[model samples]
Target: MAYHADIIVDENGKTKCGLCKVFIKDSDIYIEDHLKDTEHSDMYLQRLMIQNNIVINGKKISCLLCNQVSDVAEVLHHIDSSSHKGKMSSVKKIIEKDGGLLVLPEDITTVGSKVNCLVCDGWVEFNQEAVKTHIESAKHRRARAIVVQPLNAIFSVEGSSEDLWCKICQVYFENYIEVIFEHVDEDPIHLKNIGKLNLLIKDQNIDIEKYLHDPKEDKALCKRCGIEVPCNIDNLDRHIRGKQHLKNKK
Candidate 1:
């Protein structure tokens, strides 16, 4: 077995970092500083690859939770976790078989691993590229747009503060917001006002229309485009199935 550098310390010590924080170390820093930030530790899982001589090089794997790998994570319908024994082990096996790692980002608080994303629910990996496609994907907008109520209440119309949870691909994140929403700001997104609570989406099916409504009726605005598209589901339907929307549908 290759001893990865991250394994130098078990997951116990790894909890030192928070999912939102970033940590970079100079070679001069002590081992104590390794967990100082959550950046690399989250999306880029660093492990020590040890050789026979006990020397180890730091190896990196794209976060399996980030959804870069082609894996499908499904929530078992109506099975209570209380009755399951070591359930995570089974989930890990399924993900491994798909060449990806399936995991619950919500589990990070206790397990000591930081999730790369919270908004995307773990679909878009922690990179600029995957994020670009995910948000741009119609699926992301539809799921997240419903979240706009919680989002708008907590964030600006521009949606500066939001955490997207995508159960479909199972990645949680910030960048996915930019990918799904149009015209990200020239600034980073923030969720400073949001409490340490998460809202779970219950729909197993992807229904964009159910949540979509005429903004005019509610006097609302689009998080993207910043223009007031018709707030009604009918108008939004036209917008969604329109030329640009259809292109993204593909």
Candidate 2:
């Protein structure tokens, strides 16, 4: 497919997070100190299991990431998609777990047990202070609504309450939504196009387009050293993590 350079870059660089339910990349998402000794985060994932709207601690507010809601902000995300590699068992563990969306205190939602990042395949410490850095990483941060189905359940959610379902295809889904406004997906472009903006302010430049990958797939080009080799998605993904990119990432 002949796509715009920008779109190709966007698709290759960014993705939606099933957990946070937002569009972001490996560097955008992170863990936070909001729902530490609580189950708000985990329960939120649970409600998404089969039910459309959930009653949290007796307080019910429609989710922003569920696509069932029109206002994109109202939709919440699963957080595990970008983390877990098409792993349902891992996704299930996170869904049944608990905590909040970065900030889960005593008002917007409930809190109790803590849920771990699906990518790490581990749990966060009960203390809020504990894993603050982990919460700050791109792994736990970027969240967006997505198109997906529940893994294993006795019953299935249908119609209005359901996001997207295909009876003919024999597929049912909770209907993940897509985040409307995403900056991270456009970050690399902004960083490169506009006169390479942050070089002086942020203090570094490592030939970003070198990591620019083909969006049709996650393929990338090496424009830095001027030699074009195999800079596939995974390679480009790891390329940004080296001391090179991190040195300038503020």
Candidate 3:
């Protein structure tokens, strides 16, 4: 029996229902009858429920998307506002590009401040920036790539040696240097040995000329610690920071 004022708009000397997009005659009876029609009423209610993310309870209308509560009379203006539309757009994008990474709640209509992550198996804040941070995290990347992508995809092969050796995993592929590709791709142990010999060459702290022993095998010798360190960020960092190595360096 009641309708929002904005639902009726005057366009070029014609009165039309903005929600239903139907022209109304210039009489109170005609406008009232059109607003009371079953089709128009159903469409208006459905739009508020779905598109506007509103929950109707008695006289109170709650906007789940924007976390706002408004009177039924003000529902149209609240939903039509720019702020509510922007929130809807952000939520839509998060759902569209989820890629099986997020575990949307069963009651999507009542989604709260957080959502579960399928990859990391943990709760993440329900927002674009929070979801992005979780997806880009190392823990999430490792979990997602456990079966599909190789963890060492960032590692690069060095030189064109006939005998290929993985300095990270310490595995030699002998004359079958090309087989190293398959080894890197399928080897589960490669995840634990997060090293790329090629990356160590660029480090100023690692005196490549002095500390490096076997370039062909990608081995680095810590003269202070008297130990062979794998040519990777993890191993080199640990060796460099060791108490004995620091003591001997001085």
What is the per-residue lDDT of model 2 for residues 1-250, given as tens digits with 9 covering 90 to 100?
Answer: 1111111123556643333344433441222222221443564445443232222333344322232223222234432234222333333333333122332221223243344455454555423234455555554443312211111111234435644433212234443332111212233432243223223212223333422321122233333433233333345446555565455464
Model 3 Cα lDDT, one tens digit per residue, 1-250: 3565635657588888877778888788998888889988886666546545576778988887677888988887887889988976675566445345576443324344356776676887655566677766777656654422223332233764455444446566643423543565455676444434445433324444422223354556665566767756777777777787778778
Give the higher-TM-score candidate: 1 or 2.
1
lDDT of each candidate versus the true structure:
0.33, 0.33, 0.60
How many clashes in each structure? 35, 41, 0
- Each model's TM-score, in the order given? 0.22, 0.17, 0.30
- Could you tell me which 10 consecutive residues in candidate 3 have the lowest summed lDDT? 147-156
TM-score winner between 2 and 3, please give it.
3
Off by over 4 Å in 3: 1-40, 95-250
Better of 1 and 3 by TM-score: 3
Write one digit per residue (lDDT tens) for candidate 1, span 115-143: 23334466433223444455556765565
In candidate 2 the C-alpha lDDT for residue 178 amounts to: 25
Q: What RMSD does each model have against the real structure?
A: 19.8, 21.8, 19.4
> In model 2, which range of ten residues has the least summed lDDT?
145-154
TM-score of model 1 vs. true structure: 0.22
Angstrom error at residue 226, model 2: 41
